[model samples]
Target: MPGWEDRARIGWGPGAAPTTTVQVEACPAASAPAAWSVYTGGTWVASPACVPLVIRSEGQQVEVRLAIGAACGENN
Candidate 1:
């Protein structure tokens, strides 16, 4: 924990300029979301809306949840 302070970064707060103006899509995109590493802060990024993808295979229904949006990781 010696270098914790040096490694820490602050994120944007709610209602802040960065947080207040992210326009999310009314409908999520059909494409899958990409994986990003742990945020290092300095910027607000939530876009390319994504939705749950359900796959029905062999009488089994599997839901694939991908965190594409920074808001809650999903459109809904």
Candidate 2:
């Protein structure tokens, strides 16, 4: 079995710092390989790779979830 990496880019609009959540799901057949990424507020906040949940055969599904904290307040 081989390993690979993938990249994803996201963007945000002008406004106060806001919290966001991202979820990625991959379903592949025939012993395939895949990866995922999550971005928030135009920044690459988190990326986890080689999740064990990946199924190499059939009816395999991979799900990635992210919960972002609100940006620090100006008073901080």
For every model in order, what is the number of clashing pairs? 0, 0
For model 2 the local lDDT of residue 16 reads 20
Per-residue lDDT tens digits for candidate 1, residues 1-76, read: 1222232222433433432222222333447575443323233323333334354555776765434442344355
| Candidate 1 error regions (>4 Å) | 1-47, 69-76
The lDDT per prediction is 0.37, 0.35
Taking all chains together, each candidate's TM-score versus the true structure is 0.26, 0.18
Q: Candidate 2, which ten residues in sequence have the lowest lDDT sum? A: 1-10
Candidate 2, pairs of clashing residues: none
Best by TM-score: 1
Query: Every model's Cα RMSD, please?
Result: 15.6, 15.0
Give a tens-digit lDDT track for model 2, residues 1-76: 1121223223344442423322334445546666443333543334532221232335565643332333333332
On a 0 to 100 scale, what is the lDDT of residue 5 in model 1? 29
